[model samples]
Target chain A: MQIVVDLTRCQGYAQCVFLSPDVFQLHGQEGLLYAPSVPEDQVQRVRQAVAACPVQAILAGEEVAAGGG
Target chain B: MAGELRDGRIVVVGASLAGLRAAETLREEGFTGSLTVVGDEPYPPYDRPPLSKQVLIGGVPADTTGLPTRRDPDADWRLGVAATGLDLLERRVLLADGESLPYDRVLIATGTRARPWPDAGEAALDGVFTLRTRDDASGLAERLDAGPGRVLVIGAGFTGSEIASACRERGLDVTVAERGPAPLVGALGGTLSQLAAVMHRGHGVDLRCGVTVTALLGDGNERFVGADLSDGTRVEADVCVVALGAVRNVEWLADSGLAAGARGIACDAGCRAFNMYGIVTDDVFVAGDVSRFPHPLFGYQMLSLEHWGNAVAQAEVAAHNMINPGPLQRPHLAVPTFWSTQFGLNIKSVGVPTYSDHVVIAQGSLEARRLAVVYGYRGRVTAAVTVDMAKSLDYYRHLIETAAPFPPPPGAADRAIAADVPIPSDVPDPKGLSHEPVVALTGHLPDRRLMVVQPTR
Candidate 1:
């Protein structure tokens, strides 16, 4: 599964990091770093992180990939 | 569970973040039941965190802050209508319009409303405001856009401080009157709040701490002109924002058999509502700021959190539990997390800081205004707050979740001098504060030294 975090919308609430630490990490107070590609084992955790985001900044699935590899 | 109950009616009361998210989650979990979401507000669910910051700063219009729907929950939205009462025996929700809607399961997420000024006449003044709803934000934002000569803010809680910051960012004069010793004292405690005071003063805000607004004075036209303080002084301002805090919307459930009270509705870890007799009810669920649930992490204390992350987490748990059986249910055990951007600082917190007796600067330095304060109770880590140093918070959160010892081991990432003697957290009793704390330790106070005394001879 593919996932992307809308950096523009994210206020660095860090819900994603708390739920899927392997897939997302907060670099500083505001800089959010996340893996765009989700591994098979981490899909459920990524999905949960997507739903848990307070700002709804996480986007999952290939439908939202926007032609990115 | 009976096969006939598969397509039951599920009603969600409150159409804000929690209500909307729960409804969507119910659908995602394959709940083929009829979903009805009721909200007192006219508009759909809208994001509120930006209301105080971006909206007030003209970065975004208040009306445009509506939350984006992930997938249509296919629920019947009853907006602009209030839920008057709940009939546990009949399994129905009574609406304000004299209509009763039967439901097999109900999720109570009525949330809270901003506490208004003591006097109705004063609160009704044209320039006096209390922010909680979208309309309130829009009105206040409009007032701020009009360039009020000077703004007087009562209560220096997160909202009040953010409002003062927004006003200063707009180059408007702001005078903050806080009944507490300093801004954010109720939430972050004394040491960090001192830094907050520094930030507020440095930002050109006329911060007046340890003072309470006795009365809001108005002109003959009923427009707010100034306010009288308990310290025998008056602050003349064109606008006054009464950021006193929030009151739970549980009055409507006063007669409801649910365990609803001043703190909020009492619910079990699985988001199942309990009756007045303390028996958990399967049909009625609770979530959002309106629900107080016990957490093992906090020593089973019934924590009442008004944080955005908690509302979402609890709502999802409640929604999932509503559709599944007891053995398949999951507890809402996520640690409370919240963040605030104010006074040119990004402050984030995890766990309940109030549930601690001591705090230590785990990383960075207070002098740099970039540090993480780890809170502990009885030598066990409980919470941590970071200012411009959020990357190190997850480490402290791990320490808290693992029940690590206080003055945490110094080997973690970006580990500072953990041996720095832990100081008293200086968290005062909530009774002494004017602003409502975001996280309330509704249960036992942690680390109360109870001496075991033997029978006197």
Candidate 2:
């Protein structure tokens, strides 16, 4: 699975960080520090993080690689 | 536009967070239909929570905070237009432009607007501002950058406190006045609010609790200069921000006869709106800050929440129901979760604090500005609040979800010693609060919108 965050839309609400800490983290007061892709076992957590985002900034799917990976 | 056509035409009002999400969900849930979205704001859907924090402090651009769409909703957006009425018999949405959009189903996600100061003349003062729209934040940020001598904030709710926190972060002198005894008393109860009061004072915020700003004073040019307080004291500040809660955007639904009121348009657990006579409407649904729905955990009281999570959660549930049959429809039962960062502390809460009768410090201590307080009612855990202890919030959330016993059993904590003494939760009467609850239990307040209901009056 692939993870993508639209920096323009993210207001640093940190909803994604709380829901999927291993995949997304709040690096102090700077912003989110997250992995762009994760193993299949972590797909469920990544999807949950995407849905929980207030601004819908997080996107997770196989498209990250297919869109000219 | 992405989903296959499996159904009919759908209209979503208020092109903000909830409306945008619902439009997407309808497609994601296999609803193949033409969707139209109407919004009063000129811009496309944008993020608002940052208006008080980052935007005010110059960390982020005000006008550029647009929300990202995961997948195209393929919605025809009627921007800069308001929906005037809902003609149920004809199944059409009347717009301000005199055009009506016919729909098989409609979603109301109108959300809310900031409550302005009572006096129109006072509100017109040049330095007076209300933070709700991006424009408001951009204007205020420009003023803050000019290095005002002092900033007077008229409330101490989450938004108010966040603004003050931003002002302090910029090294500006700030004064906060609240009618309650302490900051955040209305939402987190007395004990926790006390910590908030101390944190503000410690961070050099001139916090005045148990007092209200009686009148806003201005100069000959109608520029705000100071404020007169109920405590017989006057605060001299060049810029005054009215952080007095919000007015649910339900005025357009006034004649819709869909159980709409100041408390907000009433909806059931499935996000189905109710009519004036208390009958649920099938074709009409409500979500976001505008909808008031009953929650079983909170004794079936209708909750009107302005939290970002509730808006997203309820929208998903409402959209799923809009596209599915009765047997497959899911209920909106997500536990309320809220978080705020101010005064250099990370505050987090889960469940409804107002629904509890007793509160105990399950972990940490207030003096340190780091603690987790668990709330219980009738021997069952109802809520949990943590300040600078964000990690432990989920632990307490577990207790509330399972209806754990009050004064939770010894050794429930990871600490050697835990403070579990029961005390009155001390949730204030919402009527006396100058600010609205970010997540409100509507039954307690005498009025919903703080301003005049009718202009003729």
Candidate 3:
């Protein structure tokens, strides 16, 4: 599964980072860096991160490909 | 069990973050029965954290801050109507519109509202405002844009501090009056609030601490012009924001037979609410700022959290427990986490900071303003707060969850953990502060003295 974070809407709350640290990391206070492609073992964690995001800035699965397009 | 749970009329009260998320989770968990969401406000669910930050900063319009739904929950939306009462016996929700909706299971997420000034007439003054709803933010945003002579913020809590930050950024003179010893003392404790006080002063805010607003001195025409403080000083301002914090919307549940009051509705770890007689109800659940659920991490204390993450996590847990059978149901054990951005600082905290008795600067220096303060209670890590050092918070959260020893061991921080002595956290009693604390440590007195009684066996 692939994921994309809406950088424009990301307020750097870091809920995703806390849930799925392998996929998302906060560079500084507000700069967020994340892996777009989720590892097979990390898919469930990524899904939880997606729902746990306070701003709902995360998108996964086919929605990521569609959003990128 | 799956077949038995597939269909049921589930009714969700409150259409804000918790309510919306619960509805979505119910559908996602495959509960295909009738779903109805009832809200007191006319607008649908919207994100509120931005209302005090970006909206006040004029970066986004308040009305445009609606939350994006994961998918259509296909639920009946009941907007602009308050849930007047809950008939637990008949399993019906009584609305203020004189209509009753039946439900097989009900989720109460009525959240909270801003506590207005005690004086109703003074609160009705033209320039007085409270930031809670979208309408409140929009109106305050417009007033700030008009360039008021001075803005008098009556509370130095998160909302009040953010408002002062916005005013200073917008080049408007502002004065903050806090009843505590320093800004954020009631929430983050006295140690870090000193830094907050410095930041406020450093930003040219007329910071006045240890004083309360005696009276809002409105002009003869009922327009706010200034305020008198307890220190025998008056501040002249064109606008005033009463950031005195929130009051739970549990008034409607007065006769509902639930154990709800000023501290919010009491619930078990599974989000199942209890009655006044302390009996847990299987069909009824509670979530969001309106919930007071016991957390094992905090000594099974009932923690009432007003954080965004908790609202989402608890709502999902409540929805899952509503649909699944007993054995398959899970507890809402997610540690309470919240973040605040103000005065160019990103403050993030995990676990209940107020639950701790001591705090140590485990990483970085206080002067640098980038450090992680780990809180401990009875030799175990209870919570941690990071000011601009948010990356290390998750590690502390692990320590808290595992009940790691206080003054955390080495390698938790990027550098070797400093052998700093833990100091008293100096968390003031909530009763002494004017603003409502973000996390209320209600009904859990770990330090209370208990007598040992011996009886003949």
Query: What tens digits encode model 2's per-residue C-alpha lDDT throughout B98-148?
Result: 999999889999999999999999999999999999889999999999999
Report the C-alpha lDDT of model 1 over B127-155, residue by residue, as the tens digit.
99999888999999999989999999998
- Candidate 1 lDDT over A1-69, as tens digits, reads 555454434667898999998877654456555555566899999989989998787867542111111
Measured as a fraction from 0 to 1, the native contacts recovered by model 2 come to: 0.01
- Model with the higher DockQ, candidate 1 or 3: 3
Q: Judging by DockQ, tell me the better candidate of 1 and 2.
A: 2
| DockQ computed for model 3 against the true two-chain complex using alpha carbons | 0.08
> If chain B of candidate 1 is superposed on the true chain B, what is its TM-score?
0.96
Flag regions of model 3 displaced more than 4 Å.
A1-69, B412-419, B444-457
lDDT (Cα, 0-100) at B68 in candidate 3: 59
True contacts kept of each: 0.04, 0.01, 0.04
User: In candidate 3, what are the lDDT values of residues B157-188, reduced to their tens digit?
Assistant: 88899889878878899999999898898888
Q: What are the lDDT scores of the predictions, listed in order?
A: 0.84, 0.82, 0.85
Worst 10 residues of 3 chain B by lDDT: B448-457
C-alpha RMSD of each candidate structure in angstroms:
8.5, 6.5, 7.8
Error of 3 at B266 (Å): 0.5
In what order do the candidates fall by TM-score, top score first? 3, 1, 2
Please give the distance, in angstroms, between residue B46's alpha carbon in candidate 2 and its true position after superposition: 1.0
Chain B: TM-scores of all predictions: 0.96, 0.95, 0.96
